[model samples]
Target chain A: MLSMVKECRRTKVFKPVLDHIPYAKFIGMGCEQFGDEYIFTLPSNDNNLGNPTLPAIHGGVLGGFLENSAIIHLLLKLDTPRLPKTIDFSIDYLRAGRHKDTFAICEITRQGRRAANVSMYAWQTKQSEPTAVARAHFLLEST
Target chain B: MKENNEALADFCQRGMADIKHSEVLGIETVSASNESITLKLPYSLNLVGDMETGALHGGAIFTLADQTSGFAVFSHLHPQIRIAPTLDLRIDHMRKSTKGMDLFCTARCYRYTDNIAFTRAVLYENDIDNPVAHAVGSFMFLETVKDQGWLK
Candidate 1:
């Protein structure tokens, strides 16, 4: 039991790093882990809006949200929180992100010794019909 | 042509500045032309990714690249169309950013079909010749705003 507590304490590295990221806090990004899945949440806020005409959220914000989800997932999943550095990121925007609470989920497709790949999906209304899909590779430095 | 270009440059600058997310991220337009534009993002703790290394977050950098890509699309095919939403984007982060150094991105739309426009962009700091990241993307064109005089 003590070993499990120690392991959980070690994984809490994402807290400080995320707290320092003003952009994440400003956008109100939160996360919850359910079993093997890490779900990201972005609260509805005016500052996140990009197009006043359509009242759509900024594309940058969406990309950022997905990428951040990747980081948080990797940090929590791995035993050591050595801070994941992004090597590449790709995103597909399927539909406009309307003003509302957004949610995203990340899956580590492959985690090799040096590099890890993550796939992220974000949606507002329906999970099946995602607003955007993003994939990213990160160089892990946990050693 | 000159009138169209001038009007376009004005519209691009004002509209980009007015975007709330851009304001929060401290994204500023360095210059804009009929074909492309350069944007600047100053270094701030707000964008930090690794508190230990003081490296800027990849998401912040991606935001700059994504926004620059959008501007490239606008300069290429907007006004003619009301808006161009991103259809796809791919970015390669070549290296870690220098601590406390501002980043800049210059993107240009190199191709356009009836409904799709393609763009390529580079993100760098200090020396523009050495880029820290590269991106390629496409945008989808939408309706023509009458007031935009896109048809004119």
Candidate 2:
């Protein structure tokens, strides 16, 4: 697992895929491997703010981040190199995402031949207390 | 009805301008009424998600739908309410959007109470009958906190 993570980074496999995604770059989302785990980061930017008065991150941005995180997680974990297509995404806003660096962690709940389900949690300060949680279903191409 | 629509359009435009992300995505008010409101998101290279297909990112589509839903709530409440924060949102991607084509979203606030508002939105490129995405969202009205100047 560690070797695979290193290979993905050293070979410039995932970086290019992420770089090519203009929306991911526009929001300044980055992924890093830590001890065989991948963590997605979204740096706070004024252009990503949804509610200026409350200075909160947009709900859609959060949704996007979570969805992308799930896709990237699948890329890293699954053997298939193809990008997963999102089918449906459901998100619950537990608390306001403040203007701060946010982090997301994804767990694959179930992986089938044709589809996979991923659950994601995003938080600012504490992982235990997530600002938002989401579940996404993606259609995977058979290799 | 025309005068009312014009007034709602002005209000929607102002609301869109106040959002930094909406400005970044170039979301504009297409039409506005108390019954429903439509918004447009112009296509840009910066909004692409799929490098192979050159399709617009699902996140960008979600943002447009989310904003349109919020605006629908605003149009429904009008002068009675000033702010409604999103409580939760769910989006279903029906199909991949065509590249270089602008996306449009129309949303309606179907139900509301003093504290919460419910809305649904459809996103499309050309035909409303064939939407690329659909969204349902609930928003929280801060009327109870109005005494603390929270609504101001």
Candidate 3:
């Protein structure tokens, strides 16, 4: 798993997109690619916490990760010449995300000419269940 | 009074720059009061650069709600006071926005007391009665933002 994560960091497909987002620099957003899916992980940061007594990952950060992963996957698969926009997204928090080592896995459902549909399930380390699931549609920019 | 509104708008633009998301969208307030603020989004700002196709992205909407709500409270604060961070936000999608149309946001400050403020926002393309989405959020005001290292 660590090797796969390292491979993603070196790959041309992932590096440029990661470079574009400076916040990712502070947050440490990285991914590990398997056969057809990718697992995105964010090392616990301070902004992710709620009341400090309980560590809950912020929903906005989670949503942004899912949205970015979906588009990045599309860019890698179809050789997208331009950036894709997320037209709609719906996230259901099945459970609270643990602040300890969080990660999300993405599954691309469909990639149309102008739109791509994708889903992601997020879980904490050593957990058997998913904490949150999101379905998002990305509108590809016409080349 | 209008000058105060303009100053508040300037303050919001400054606070929002901290997020970095607004740097790309270029959020500028047309008008604001203690109640609500109106935001304008252009066509090129579309994530897909084709708003006419109803391709408005959710991240854009989230950022807008975050800002409008932030301004909804910061507008009422003293000039030197720092803006608050969003504690949480809940958005329910109503319908897809019309493609190729500009987005106008009307965010309302429902409750602004001492430490926390509550806000609700409605996003529209051309229709007022029928909105594209509705969102509610809470912001936590702090006396000194630098002391709150947790936000970083």
- Per-candidate total of colliding backbone pairs: 0, 0, 4
Clashing pairs in 3: B51-B100, B52-B99, B52-B100, B54-B99
> Candidate 1 falls in which docking quality class?
medium
Ranking by TM-score: 2, 1, 3
Task: Write the residue-wise lDDT of candidate 1 on A43-104 in tens digits.
Answer: 88888888776678898889989998887777667754476788999999998899998999
Superposed by TM-score, candidate 1 places the C-alpha of residue A37 at a distance from the truth, in angstroms, of 2.5
**What stretches of model 1 exceed 4 Å from their correct place?**
A1-17, B1-8, B77-81, B143-152
TM-score of chain B of 1: 0.84
**True interface contacts retained by model 1:** 0.74
Write candidate 2's Cα lDDT for B94-149 as tens digits: 99999899999999999988788999999999999999999999998765443323
Q: TM-score per candidate, in order? A: 0.88, 0.92, 0.56
Q: Candidate 1 vs candidate 3: which has greater DockQ?
A: 1
Indicate whether candidate 1 or candidate 2 has the larger TM-score. Answer: 2
Q: What's the distance in Å from true for residue A74, model 3?
A: 12
Off by over 4 Å in 3: A1-32, A35-37, A41-62, A67-103, A106-143, B1-4, B14-19, B49-54, B147-152
Q: Comparing 1 and 3 by lDDT, which wins?
A: 1
What is candidate 2's lDDT per residue for A2-63, written digit by digit as tens? Answer: 35444776764566657757888988898877877789999999989987767889888998
Q: Write the per-residue lDDT of candidate 3 for residues B1-152, one digit (tens) a residue.
A: 43436666665555444444444456666677655788766644334322235455555565566567656765555454654666656666576656567777888777877888888888887786888778777777766544433222
Interface Cα RMSD of candidate 2: 2.4
Any idea how many clashes model 1 has?
0
